[model samples]
Target: MPKLISQINQLQQLGLNAKEGVVYQPSRGFFKIVYQGLILPNLPAPLRYFNYISLVGQPRIPLCYNAHTITTSAIDTATVLVSNSQHSVGHLKTYSIRRQCQFDSEQYKFDKTDLIEWKIPKIHLQRLDLEMGCNLTIHISENISNNSALQWGVSDYWSTLCLCEGEVFYKGQKYQVEGLGRFRHARALHLPFLSLCFYTCQIINLNETTQLAFSQIRNQWNIILCSRLDIQEFGKPVESFTEDVNLHIHRVYPKVRTPNGKEMYLPREFSWQCKKNGKIIFELYAQSRGDYKFGLAAGYVGSFQYQLSWNEQCLQGEGGYCEYIDCRPLRWQEKNQDEKILDKLMLLQPCLYKK
Candidate 1:
């Protein structure tokens, strides 16, 4: 077995040997633990989508954040990795988080000047078996680049690992709950009014020997910013590069109410084509199986669990699609006669409309 796989199994077996601690209540019903650590060594560099400051202008700074999760059914193990930081002209709000269990609890606070470090915590999941659940926490830290023009805020830097003991389906195959499932996301934040950004990422596990990850980002007006694709085989990097890319939304979920009662639309299915140096490389199609919603500073974003199939060159796998769009600009209310007249006047003047 790979060293990484062996280490994960040893950690997971600790859950079976250890006693359960006081239950930790997550913001949601599921149990969650946020810690920082280097779970994998010699991983590929992350794809940079856009720099908020460079694109939008200064005093608009860039922030960067990264989150990664890995799971395996063969050994019933799950792991999460995360790192986040920011550079800005002035201090923003101080962020803090507190999680308590019967025997242990943790509180973290981040200020403007302090560079936040990743925390790794040792955690134990209770009743981790078929139809049972398990939880564990550990602390880990690593040196990462802080020079990106994009930075994710302090509060957004943490990662959560949720484990449920049950039977889950993947690629129409049934396996005992041991190991082999994963989900991950990372982002950089900036003022909503300053600019608009769109990004899509997908990972396809072709088989035990190969995997592919791809992403593309667009600006507010839907102009392409950058795109990247990376390929790996047997846990070793094979190829990685930036390319011209296009993504098409084939199905949309329509507007749905958020927790705060605001409405947003999300894509449920999409297809993409990627090209390198003017040569078409691959085409991919993906459809969502379900959606998960989470809150953000500007608004709520939704992520869809998805299954993806690509050209034979790329293979097929399952993953997720997430979207974040501020609805304030799109929101409209009833207009009176005067407002309607103004609207018509603006429409009649092409120059004014352009302005």
Candidate 2:
């Protein structure tokens, strides 16, 4: 833990950044506050040296959530921003938090003695009072498979940076579409992102009944998010630079990811699904992005998860191809590098983005 703090102290020297905060994001639904950005160990600043720490977490429920997270820096007496939802990572969920840190006598220590934690209460999406998105008249099935033999399709616009089509495995085979949406990763998380394979953050029913997969597709070039909610990605204009974001669900059908690996295809097709009285009038498809291929990077969940972590760290410029940090900081190298504060801070930013 002291090592984690030492590393964090080295990072605060920098002005802006983000990182993976916990050793592992709680798998069964839990929140972790990663201590990042600390002033130089021997600071000569006139006033209190302050920095921001972020918490990256997801909700365990199949519903939208209202989550609150409070973190006391490894260094005590720091006042923090407690404004983001630390829950419901899938839809209308929030990385939604921003806090101010002010240090006191015991600044380097976490308040766990008194237990500063994330309080999560499950909220069902069925309880959401608002409609999710532009309703599709498409009829889905109990099994969620295309009973009508609906080959996957995508709709794209040049103005929309998204390729309008992406693919993943469904029932042991790869399914292709003009554009399928699900949670991906940061811009660096492209094509070989996660060891060159597809990854998802969660899968749940909007009303807690129908099941679907949620993945994140980021507009790599712009760094804006193109989120995947309910199998299909919503074509929304989003600014990734902002502190707010939203994702919706597809409640009409059950989305599926095949086991094994059967391959799907794309046609030089232009099509669309229309309804006069809420029904498909004809098969609608647009010029799809050239067909592409993707699936498991190469392993089971456990092996893949670790690989992703190592990849994230590497991209973020941290050493140690593998390290699980939980409130515990890395040891200062004391190498001739001389321990720059910005370097230390950057190390933590890649762990978990604290909003």
Q: Compose the digit string of candidate 2's lDDT tens values, residues 130-230.
A: 21111011111111111111012110011111121222222233323232112111110001111111122222111212223323332112122323323
Give the lowest summed-lDDT range of ten residues in model 1.
47-56
Task: Give per-residue CA lDDT, model 1, range 160-235, as digits (tens).
Answer: 2212122222223332332211222222232332333344555544553455556665443444455666565542
> What lDDT is reached at residue 197 by model 1?
38
